[model samples]
Target: ALQRTPLQHEQSDILEQQARDEKVALEKATDQGQYFVFCDTAPLLTAVYSDFVFGDTSLYPRARELHARYAMTLILEPDLPWVADGLQRDGAHVQKPIHLKIAQELRGMGSLHYRVTGSGEARLACARAAVLAGNTHIAATGWRRTI
Candidate 1:
């Protein structure tokens, strides 16, 4: 088990508190089923994905372990491609498509319901689409909606 830094511990505490509060709110807001969307800045993915790609292959095992514990839909959006250090050709990062990478990660995860949509109108359209398709939770960058 990795020991969390002070800041990491604090962040975990805050997230735990928020999860509890959201659970209560979700219970009150819906009768049939509840959907919880966790949204945060893309830096979270930048850090984790970068580590998973560039660091030792052991990092992937840790990521899988963490994912199993959470069991929520993960949507990864980064400004660059997740390339391991030795795998990248010169300047390949410049042309890497973030949306494609996100879609790939979603597929690799395999279990959770996941998709990649742009942050603006496309995201809204995707949300509407999910609602129409009967998804209980729609999570995106800085946006959470229940429909």
Candidate 2:
């Protein structure tokens, strides 16, 4: 199991205390990870629009430049059984069973790794099972943990 230092627990407590809602708390929790902020469709669209309207028409380029500056990987997750109008990108990974193979390819390409969570209540059950199984490291949609 991953060891959680007292400081880490304190930080988690502080984040939970300060968050306005559970979603905010979850995001804050994930922020504690080395590579956090895996962008989903909504945030990406909001960011694109914010930059396009208020900043520059070359906003996407500028954003990519900034991401490159920070050496951050922009990972796209469309969820499995891909839906139409979902976020599409050159390097985006589809959320289908076949996409598992695609994810392996991307991992080989040094893009990013991926995992599929079970559906509905099963998802939470899976997470709890992982925790019980002594899986210290975990990264999921709304939460991550090293404990």
Candidate 3:
């Protein structure tokens, strides 16, 4: 059996505590009047690489759980071609699996989600319409339409 080292255990504890604190703070900060709050990477892709590299999967579940619990997720297939800055990214072809992986993760969590696809204003409009329809009972009514 591969037992976790003491340092690994400590690191996991710290990460778990940080996630708990962040959730508490976010819950406290949410205003009753607010319809939504935005998170850039709602379903964080951080663990996709680290788990591949270091076998550290502690980050994935916590991020996924928090994202699903706190927000209505919108995943955009992004109309733009993937361009790497040469410093901060994996190539687009490489990232496809990561994107699909997150979607699969969210789907397994039974999350209500929207896949927004388009360019510029059209994309924004599609997201808006999806959200509105979702919030207004499309989820309940089973009204799936191609946007």
Best by lDDT: 3
Worst 10 residues of 3 by lDDT: 1-10
Tell me the tens digit of each residue's lDDT in model 2 across 48-94.
43332344233333333322221123233334344444332213231
Ranking by TM-score: 3, 1, 2
For all candidates in order, the CA lDDT equals 0.43, 0.35, 0.60
User: Per-residue lDDT for 1-147 in model 3, tens only?
Assistant: 124322334444545554565555556555455445555533244544445435678777766655545435787774578876645455676666667876787687776788888888998899998788667764575544210
Candidate 2 local lDDT, residue 112: 28
lDDT per residue for candidate 1 within 20-58, as digits (tens), equals 554556566556464443444222233243443444233
- The superposed Cα distance between candidate 2 and the true structure at residue 46, in angstroms, equals 14
Q: Which residue pairs come into collision in candidate 3?
A: none
RMSD of 1: 10.2
Residue runs of model 1 more than 4 Å from their true location after superposition: 1-34, 41-48, 51-53, 69-102, 131-147
